[model samples]
Target: MDKSYDPFKYSSDSLEDVAEQISDVLKCPITIEDVNHRLLAYSTHSDSTDPARISTIIGRRVPEKVIHSLWKDGTIPALLKSQEPIHVKNIKEVGLGNRVAISIWKNNEVLGFIWAQEINKSLTSNELDLLKKAANAVQNKLLYLQKGKMKKEEREQEFFWKLLTGNTLRHDDMADGFYQLNKTMPPIYSVVLFRFTKPITEKMEKQLNYLLETTQLVHICLVTIDYNELILLVSPKEEQPLNQIKQFLRVMEKQMMQRYNIEHFAMSIGGIYSDISSVHIAYKEALAVLKVKERYLSDAEHLMSFSELGIYQYLDVLAEKRKHNRSPNYPLSQLEKYDNEHHSNLIETLETFIDSDSNVKTAAKQLNVHVNTLNYRLKRIQEITGLDLKNVNEKFSILLEIKIRNMGL
Candidate 1:
């Protein structure tokens, strides 16, 4: 080991220099890579480099084939689990010679890797010890970088949360915050809210974060508002913003289902609003859409948009009006009262009947009841409400009334 080697002296600016120093002390070329195998830094010595290392540097990532080969040989897994340097005697089949690799770690988490190619001779114990010191230096550098990044993300998330929650009012303030985050104030943005049946797991959250980072959208911000919900704000770069969002959401749904086995989830997208200050409007619209989905479109698995909500978009307005004004009691409320008094489910029967498009046989089949029993129930409903089932207008009005009541308005 080099008595003068000091891991504490390196900073972000000196990462490449540290790699060069390690290379000089160990008499081997060095390559530094993130856990994903993306190249971070490498020594300048090129004379003794192998084809794999050269390809990794050129491509900025380790080739998939090389990674697969390493996985098959259990080398990648071993390095991931251990902080000690691992020596590969030979990997000529994958266009590499002998090399020693150490996991750059912090708090038991493997952050990256530092690899030293053993070109002319195997690394001695002393050289391996020096490599460990280099790995510790890289770990410290990564920790510093990660902390800085986390602070920036925290600030951005706070700004985004404030924007969504309508805490920040002035456009200039928002613009300044966006500028601090290195983001522009989007002219128009839409919010998408995800609701999960269960709280998201750490693995699920990590996968979602990775997906958000890798998504092809040009401008986006994702934040978790609750344990079971995630909010995504997107500013589309294309002419058709709605279409772009829908397509991105579809891809996300498929990946979530296929990759993560996430079966019970729903997503609602709000209408696009032009001004940053009006983003809360979009957020409310998204919440409304989610409510509509839960009440009316519970069976739908794809993303629901505010524009597609039809008459239900105005339900929230009606609900508020109903709150302040004394409106006529909904006719469906009469049936609900009767059902509760009698311990019956005439409301469910009526809903199933309407949902089946007024087909008595279909409704009966859906309800798992005999058609005559369904007819008797329909007759009783008409008798109780004095509404004629044969009249189209009456049926339509009843259906609308039932929908509004189902929304708990």
Candidate 2:
């Protein structure tokens, strides 16, 4: 805002001031590099541990090779060319932790760029929002200084998003882009999109990335959403057995609960769908399953495969009462005769008494008889079946037989 102010000095110094404030607030390493690709200023926390000091990096062009490789890959080019800040993943070459890059300029002159590396921690919602606001503010400051250099960058960034989301090109161009994307992946892979009810924190995101890295278990593409959900694209080389995956999921669930201190985030695992494009539908199915939890809460995490839910059958009927009837192959008239001759309300009463676990009072109340009368009926039941109603095994078998015989009749 000062007229005699060096725009570079102002932005870099201002960035350092803001970074320090942010570092104090968030306790993260915040570093700002100038337009010349030199480190102008960094947070005190970063300076303490970083061997490369800002003085050494100031006024030097960042290595051509570093930006060149990224440009060739079209990642950095998209951001730098567009004049817009971008959030990038898998930028391991830049350094450990997640990186956010923003180009800086003022009065149509390129001021430089700022890079913030989230060290040892994932970006929190409030932190990310603050960073985004900070980045845009810095960009606007540059635009105020170097007016009229912003239009191209905006268009380029929009193009990048459309391309990334597969909304930019014709069907053929889309296929080609997908082909290039898949060239880095295994030939036969499966994509599973797991959705959660809560937003994944930076720590959980890093933990998930670490798990995938260590196990070499699944090639995962994680996209965090505003709705506090993760769109995970898991491409496993060669189909993994369901059991092994289930075990891993169980372990992950336990770790998430213990480490993050959150629970009841239902994961709806989609069926293994081959090819990348099918991944979108897989996400839909996973979402459907999560939505249907009311119907399947009894199973909990055990019900991963939605196709196995048999939802229709369940919705149409309650549990079938065990039919204690003879097989259809047996004579119908025989069953009728058995029922006619077995007019022994005594046996029926005994069966009911035993099924009630020999609780004479309960059986008596159920049968509208006295406890002594129910006990006498039970004694006669032991005489007929040669099984003690008092024993659990005997009681279970007798109850089962009674159910079967009832069904037969």
Candidate 3:
């Protein structure tokens, strides 16, 4: 059983404190309104230090003009009702100057709104990011405070676990959790895992975000690992028909390769799974499919599932690999040296043979190389590396070595 949260508790006070901080950073005035559109609290840059200005609006109803302006326009109110954050660019129509307003919500429940006025100038990317972070923090603080008031941690956890087990929806509780977590996540979602022909970069981070936003799938949660891979949690509503998640990933791959000038970015997508806990499983499957994608895809787009490959049993290993900083063992220098120096076609040969399960005939046919030439190169590989193909352990090591090499490690 959960205890009810007290409105007069310190948690609510802490939320107000956070809201004040957000108002300061965004350089805008804030008016936190209740569901009835009554002003619960208000803070302004000019009088934030003055407790009187903050208290003046406590019992007052929000101005009719502000309500009309926010709701009459439809977008912000709709976003508030939907519990999704809304960013309005040209908010000057309401006498607030050009601005971006982020609605604060909990479980699709409209708690209040935060208006970040772009009065002085256009917000730089960094500033915008900072504003977003601050706003989200305020929202998170409020959510925890609200939950504290309801004494609902046990109920929330039970509901969340049930959501995962499919025993119940408890959508109200689940939505509350999602709303709180969203503040700490990316604005768009995709189920993408990164592989390093090279380590991750800020450019990759920004690019991933851009892809989600441009795709118009807002409410994304991105988990980044140290090795430059990312896992995206995307909203289904933004997903397009005929544009499967795989295709969307492919488009991202193409853009990263061609437009961003990143030639070797590898992305694998597990087919979409709607349940929240299944996200981890989906990401693992995507990583597994990605390991094979490089050799087989040959292009920007490739989608495969571990189950489809009958490698579902190895899903745990794949999941471990998806963790950041676990680079493929073969160094990029060695792979490049082999690819660039040996007309031996050693790099392609290794990738293809491993992908084809060390089948000489199949590897040769796929590479369009004579069987004799393939065998000769395999001999050279043994001579150079002191490894025998007939040895199962050595074969596994060699296959992994080849993967490391091709990953440009």
Most TM-score-accurate candidate: 1
| Model 3 clash number | 10
Tens digits of lDDT, candidate 1, 103-172: 9988867778998988778988878888888887788777777688679878877888888899999989
What do the candidate models score in CA lDDT, each in turn? 0.78, 0.51, 0.53
- TM-score ranking of the models: 1, 2, 3
Candidate 1, clashing residue pairs? none
Worst 10 residues of 3 by lDDT: 1-10
Candidate 2 local lDDT, residue 227: 49
Per-residue error (Å), model 1, residue 366: 12
- Cα RMSD (angstroms) for every candidate in the order listed: 7.4, 15.8, 16.3
Candidates in order, TM-scores: namely 0.59, 0.35, 0.33
> Which runs of model 2 end up more than 4 angstroms from their true locations?
1-175, 179-215, 239-241, 299-301, 312-409
Best-performing candidate as measured by lDDT: 1
On residues 1-409, what C-alpha lDDT tens digit does candidate 2 reach at each position? 2333222233433656766755565566666554434454566754433222232344233443344345545655465455555665544454333556666555444465666555666666665555545554566544443344345434433433443354643645534544544434323322233455667776556555433433334544333333455545455546554444555567567655654455766665665655545544555566666655544454333566556554322331322332232243222233334447876575467566765667788879989988887777667555654665567875665454444454332
Clash count, predicted structure 2: 23
Ranking by lDDT: 1, 3, 2
Model 3: residue 10 alpha-carbon error in angstroms: 36
